[model samples]
Target: MNFKFHHIGIVVNSIEQYEKQMLPNKKVREVIDKIQNSKLALYENFNESYIELIEPLNENSTSFNSLKKFGNHLNHLCYKVGPFSELENFMRDRKWIKVFGPVPAALFENQKVVFYLNRNSQLIEFIISE
Candidate 1:
């Protein structure tokens, strides 16, 4: 149940626009993730920490409602976790409910990612450690 801070996900109306306006000179990796129904732009710092910008692909996208409600804001905190099998026990012990995933993520080279909502209703993402 080891957790390492990975990235802060931000929901944006447009990845291209956000990158242009906010991260003009930063190196970013962009991906169109069909599985997640969102476009993503990842900016990784020297320490391996990242800032993930997410844009919904359509109305059915998972981030659509969040974007509609919050309008371009911090979405979730992601962590890299190992011994992937222990996730269930860890979530149960902490009373965190799985909301989505354990699905392959295009942004992480298809590594599995899971979403959870803690008691406080804070969304969190857990990506299987490489």
Candidate 2:
């Protein structure tokens, strides 16, 4: 019954490109460098959680090439919660379309996250941390 809306993912041609065109005078480069040092940076009333910034890793990655295919838009938003299985069970009866990831045992020890694409325009991610 509790969750924190972590961050929103916006797909752009490039963060640098967006920063240059949208925020011409701001010291965006310095801000980005500071962020690289801390991974997550809290701004005004929002927290920025960066996965990777320089390239399109997968077909699903938001980058110049990928965004052209997916369309420049908000890719998704992640919410942090406790006990993903319990959340899954609770939401199951409500008819949400659950797709991909409860990453099974592997040497990497990655936690599972769930994505649900419903009638909503945004892809929702349930981030489960161990």
Candidate 3:
């Protein structure tokens, strides 16, 4: 499948408290302040991968629903890819069942994204930057 590692999505009940727990440094705090809402706090590790700490707007939100089931856990591993159909077919052939969309993601510059559940029940997100 045509894919590029983007970020790891983490569902958290509260973004502020979680950030403090994960990243409790002045420099990290400075970077966190730059991003409004600051839901997705960037903590660069060995690799340049990002950890998106997503908080639910309300009980009805997708993140909240996921939080209820999973409880502050790794929701998905995202990948930025192209020619959407090619990857879609690849997943289908491998029997990686589609879970959620090819929906328009306002956060990702209104790009199209989708989700699939792998054999281990680990959710994988595919985002296409068109």
Candidate 4:
């Protein structure tokens, strides 16, 4: 049940636009996750933390509504978890509802990820640790 801070997810109109303006000259890994219907970019900082920039692939994308409502803004916090099986019980105990996933994420080398919503409606993402 160990959880480690992994990254912050930000919804943006375009990952390329955000990278060019904010992460210029920084190395970034980009991928298209069809399961999530979004384009993603991961930038790892010197401190080993990461920032995940997400852009909707189309109007049907899950992120599309979020982007339209919040514009370019912080979307969620992600954590790396060691034991995937414990996630359900852990989240339920805290009154968090599963919103999306437990699906393979293209941006994470096909690793599984799950999304949850807390009582206050804040989103959280959990990626199964390697």
- State which candidate has the highest lDDT: 1
Which has the higher lDDT value, candidate number 2 or candidate number 4? 4
> For each candidate, what is the lDDT?
0.88, 0.49, 0.70, 0.87
lDDT of 4 by residue, 32-128 (tens): 8888889898988656778899999899887899999989999999998966778888998998999988889998899999999999999999998
For candidate 2, the C-alpha RMSD (Å) to the true structure equals: 7.3
- Across 22-118, the per-residue lDDT of candidate 1 in tens digits comes to 6434556789899879999888654778899999999989999999999999999999998567987899899999999889999888999999999
Each model's TM-score?
A: 0.92, 0.58, 0.77, 0.92
lDDT of 3 by residue, 1-130 (tens): 5667888878888877787887542322122211223244444544555677777766656566778887999888999888678887888788998987887665565578888999888899888765
What's the residue-level lDDT of 10 in candidate 1? 93
Span of 10 residues, lowest total lDDT, candidate 2: 34-43
Which residue runs does candidate 2 get wrong by more than 4 Å? 21-55, 58-66, 104-111
Worst 10 residues of 3 by lDDT: 27-36
Clashes of each: 0, 0, 0, 0
Q: Any idea what lDDT model 4 has?
A: 0.87
